[model samples]
Target: MTAKYPNKEHVTYATFLSSNRREKVDGVEIGTQFTKVVVNHPLQENEELVRPMKHCKTIGDVHSEGTSIAWPSICIQKING
Candidate 1:
């Protein structure tokens, strides 16, 4: 994604899945889940000094291939002395 400023300068962003949980994807009676995204800071021209601005992106903007859940097995074991 690219964002343009007043001067028409564009910024490129490379987003990744910093962290996530099952709850975010689906409400399975689990705890709340959050997704964190990081962007590559680029140099921007100002009056004199160049500063790196923080990029803000919504969670919905993220794209995923798919998701799967691994349920734990429940069984009883028998022991003999």
Candidate 2:
């Protein structure tokens, strides 16, 4: 997928499934399964810093307008072992 910035700069992202498995059923209980994926060349700090305004492109302007915005990208990703 390609992400286009407000300045018209495009960034390509490639995702790969590192590992995946089906859930196994034990007796009458059902187990949960998950897939582990890795995104090649994920965005870095420098990239964000260089384009801080790019981050706000989606929400447009928010100058004390009392408008609520949802920024899913800002959510933190948790790693499990």
Give stretches of model 2 more than 4 Å off: 1-14, 22-33, 45-81
lDDT of 2 by residue, 46-74 (tens): 23311223223222231122222221122
Model 1, 1-81: lDDT tens digits are 223322323332333333333433233322223232333333332211111212212211221212222111111111244
* Candidate 2 positional error at 31, Å: 8.2
Q: Each candidate's lDDT (Cα)?
A: 0.25, 0.26
Q: lDDT: which candidate is best?
A: 2
List the lowest-lDDT window of 10 residues for candidate 1: 69-78
RMSD of candidate 1 to the truth, in angstroms, is: 19.5
* Clash count list over all predictions: 0, 0
Question: Residue 71 of model 1: what lDDT?
Answer: 15
